[model samples]
Target: MVLIDRIRYLLEKLLEVFTIFLLLALTSIVLAAVAFRTFGSSIAWYDEVASIGLAWLTFYGANLAALKRAHMGFPGIVSSAPPALRMALFVLSEAIVIGFFAVIAYYGYHVFEILAWDRLVSLPSISLTVTQSAIPISAALFIVCECLTLPEAWKKMRAGVDSEHEAIEEAIRLAEEDLKENRS
Candidate 1:
C-alpha cells in the first residue's frame, strides 16, 4: 500500500508537470505563429507543430485528470444504489475503462509500425512516430492512474459518498469565504 501510494503521488506530480509543459509549448507556438503571420511571414511548420502540441496536451492532460479523479461522474446516482449493486457497477465500469485503454495501447503500438516511414508534412526532418507516441503512452499512464485510485474509489463508493455533491458544496463554501474577504 505504501509503495502504491508513493507511485501514485509520483505519477500525479509527473503528469501535472507534463501537462503544464505541453500547455506552455502550445501557447508559445501559437504566439510565435500569430506574430510571424502578422509580419506577413508565415512559418511552414507552425500548423503541423501546433496540432501536434494540441494532441500531446490532450493526451497528457487526460492522464492528469484521471490521476486527480477529476473526470465527470454522477456520484449521487451511484451512491444511492444498494451496496452490492454499487460495488458491481463500480467494478464493471473500471474494468471496461481499463480494458478499453489496454486495447488502445495495443493497437497504438501497431500504429507505430505503419507510421515508421512517415515524416511530418511541414517538417520532413521530424518523424511521425515521435509526435504520435502520445496515444500508447497516455493510455498506459491512464491505466496506472486508474489502478492507483481504485482503492479510494471503492472506499468512497462503499461509504455512499456523493463526491460531486461534496465538490459543489466545497466550491460554494470557498466562494462564500472569498466574498466575505472582499467585503471586509
Candidate 2:
C-alpha cells in the first residue's frame, strides 16, 4: 500500500511536468504560427500539430483527473445508500469506469495498425501513430492511477465521507480563513 502511494506520488508529479511541457510547447507553436501568418506566410504544420497537442492534453488531463479522484461523480447519492448497497454501487461504478477505459485501450492499440502507413499531412516524416499514441497511453495511465488509489478511496467511501465533500469543506474553510485574515 505504501509502495502504491509512493508510485502514485511519482506518477502525479510526472503528469504535472508533462502537461506543463505540452502547454508551453503548444503555446509556442501557436504564437509562432500567428507571427508567421502576420508577416504574410502561414505554417503548414500549425493546425495539424496544434490539434494533436490538444488531443494529447485532453487524454493526459483525464488521466490526471482520475489520479486525483476529481472526475465527475455523484458522491452524495452513493453515500446516502445503506452500507451494503453502497458497496455494491461503488463496485459497479468502478467496474463500469475501468471497463470503459479497457475497451478504449484495446481499440486504441488496434488503431496503430490501421494508421501504420499513414503520416501527418503537414509533416510527412512523422507517423500518425506517433501522435495518436496518447489514446492508449492515457487510458493505461488512468487504469494505473485508479488501481493505485483504490484502497484509500475505498476506505474513505466506507467511512461515509466522500472526497468530494471533504474537498468542498476544506475549500470553504480555507476561504473563510482568508477572509478573516483580510479583515484583520
Clashes of each: 0, 0
Residue lDDT tens for model 1, 1-184: 8998999988888888888988998999999999999999999999999999999999899888888788987678889999999999898889998999999899998899999999999899999999989999999988989999999888999999888987899999999999999999
Candidate 1 off by > 4 Å = none
Q: What is the C-alpha RMSD of each candidate to the true structure, in Å?
A: 1.2, 1.0
The 0-to-1 C-alpha lDDT of every candidate, in the order given, reads: 0.91, 0.92
Stretches of candidate 2 exceeding 4 Å from the true structure: none
TM-scores, one per candidate: 0.95, 0.96
lDDT of 2 at 101: 91
| lDDT score for candidate 2 against the true structure | 0.92
Pairs that collide, model 2? none
Give the Cα RMSD of candidate 2: 1.0
**Candidate 1 steric clashes:** 0
